[model samples]
Target: MKKLDYQYALKPDWQSDARLEKQTTDNQSNIVNLTLSDNTGFAELNPEQYTWLLSFTYQSTHKKKSGSVCVILENNEQNTVNHRQYFEAGETGTRYLNLSGLLADYQTLSQWQLVYDHCLLMPDATLLGFKKPDIHHGPILIIAPHADDAELAAYGVYSDFSDQVWITTINAGQNVQSLDRQYITGLDDNLKDAVSRKAKIRAWNSMTTPLLAGVKFERLSSLGYFNLTKNTFYNASEKQQNDSVCPELTPAISRALNTMTLPNDESNISSGKRLVDDLASLLDQIKPTSVFVTDPEIDPHPKHIMSAHALALAIQQSGHIPDRVFMYVNHLRKIKKFPYGPEHARTALPPWYESTSKFGHYSCYSHQLTLKTQKEKVVSFDSMHDLRSKPRIQKMLKAWWHKKVLKSGYQFYGYHHYFQTHIKANEVFTFVDGKTFSDSLLQKE
Candidate 1:
């Protein structure tokens, strides 16, 4: 008889460690089964002895109810394991083996054996063949309200899954300006022009760099809006000029002057139509298995809402909708008030359960953004501490911490709050196979 150098080490002492009383030779290979005593398990083994070690813990009451086994195979070198095959007990106390077909490759080897430190349960479980793992392949499209919206919303997802992402912005044109000379008296002509141009470039750069790190960035056409000049409306007369305008009017007009502001009705319709066309074209070209878009309900910005509508419409119009479509919310700022409520709570739509609900329900995939904490390092510490002054700073610090943490997950600006209501760390959307769409109608086989 030929001798092999392999050996077994039992853990917790096997109930019975009997070697095979007899070995049979069949098809140029050796076959042997070593019986084991009850309440015995095997210890960990090094790579030199066995190519792989499979361990399982069967239920005490139902011996085969809850146990798992797997083997690690050497890839390039005999002493190093690379690939693995696993078998686990299923819900009904039945054992299922994963990747059992690969065992055929080992059949040609002269020395192969099964070593169980514990007894085999009655009616030994049969091994099932293995199947290949699914591969994720598709273009992840991200739509944002502003130029930097997608970067702020899904940056982490983009970073983690690089080269598989594409981002599009609805409003991409430069802001308009009016002539107000109050603060420009001391500035030189060349300096002022340089300053203005540099500012615009900076804003554009800020939004593009992070996205370019791992995604394809595209700027969509802008909806026409009013312009501002010298901190005032382009058409505003001298009397209306001031260092500080009313709080409400300041932001609205400021954004408009900086970027074109579209007329409510026209911009909405135009943005919607354009988004639909752009998305449809991209879909037809990529034919992605899965698609991700912004949740229409949680999109407060008019542009975001309009863009989502257009995307939904485009998918409906296209003959082939993706196998799965997932929607993420960007502005989770409002989630502080209703952390446990449905996503619709933060949107303009009614709850999904309501009779008048307009927003559709989709699977919610939520994940926490990771953050690193620094150990205490005193640097010019201050002795004064006041309880009254801490609340405001604490609130601000909390918000800042939240933002920092979210970056670790999806690089989105508001993911933490957005994901609170959508409890799943990651949600999956699956389209009914062989389904088609036409005129927004779904055709199922």
Candidate 2:
């Protein structure tokens, strides 16, 4: 996990002179900056400490030019392990490299690098209309379907404007149907009992969620909670006394997988209406300048779509119109080629949404981060492991806490992928053209 640092890459004096020359030319308009990151950590590895390469994606920007890259690995230690390779890139696209073998060859290597001279692009001139950085104003509000989504999608925005933000978690944060407790083996004897009990614990962990909101402006009251998932509502309504609910095991979203109808449409819609009224009232109270929600129209996840439906209806029903609304993506579209980051935002729309929608198209903007904000983002991401308020939650149910989130939890599918997105300098959002969300669209079809 240990790898070389671009800021302090080890090089011979001649190479240092070359690096200075490269830097001097990079000051020109048409240059592709070559750098390295994702040091995959050094153990006192007897010089093999930081010897590893991750097969991951990285991007470098250029003045709309074509270029090739060359990398060199050298160990300053007594046992020299040196190697070199070449790569080609078009314009400012992403390239994925697997240097595990290269690192393995330099077992006792001290440092490595992307060879400056070979990192060249040719037959390229200039690109017109590069966008300026995205500027977001406060007080911003983020609405997330599950516990870690807000952080995954836009931690840069949250930390940079933490003092001027609020968060609302629309789900109870329990992926209940995914209730296999095998990972807790030896940690708990009564896995079934622990599973049932863990739902409430997830809700409790959720209460302190907004603590991750921002350093300065986000307050406890700035956050709001609503657990509207189909499996469970923090508070349930039993209208028609005889209304039958789905068996507790069924995921609520599964009721209508191909469409967005709530289960037993009449019955659930009644429940949805109650939710609509409550959310409308809350929106009226908050009167936010902007409302943030997940993409419902095309996001394949039903709970997310349902949340969006409910939100649009609430705005329609409440008669409270915010100046703007922002839509963030999760789960549906094929993720852009670049995964980890020097850049955080994506500009593409979901193919399905794009092909079918009358709205046509919209722009993408990135609320790029500062160095301080980037550090705060990494710290905020790492804090997910700290288990704050551990005394009470763990004291009452240590086994569930250990297996579900902390010790053995990375096995959960989305765990690693979610945090990896933060290794960048920006976060992106699709700006839904406001005119598309006109009054008519807010009303029921």
Q: What clash pairs does model 2 have?
A: 1-40, 1-41, 2-40, 2-41, 66-121, 67-121, 162-214, 163-217
Task: Estimate the lDDT of model 1.
Answer: 0.32
- What TM-score does candidate 1 get on C-alpha atoms? 0.37
Off by over 4 Å in 1: 1-135, 173-207, 211-213, 216-272, 332-361, 367-445
Tens digits of lDDT, candidate 1, 95-179: 2112222233332211323321112322232221111112147665555545445443444455555576655444432222322
**Ten-residue stretch with the least lDDT total in model 2:** 8-17
Which candidate tops lDDT? 2
Q: Residue 208 of candidate 1: its Cα lDDT?
A: 45
The TM-scores, one per candidate, come to: 0.37, 0.51
Evaluate all candidate structures by whole-model CA lDDT and list the values in order.
0.32, 0.40
User: How many clashing pairs in candidate 1?
Assistant: 20
- For every candidate in turn, the CA RMSD to the true structure comes to 19.1, 15.5
Q: Distance (Å) between predicted and true CA of 364, model 2?
A: 2.3
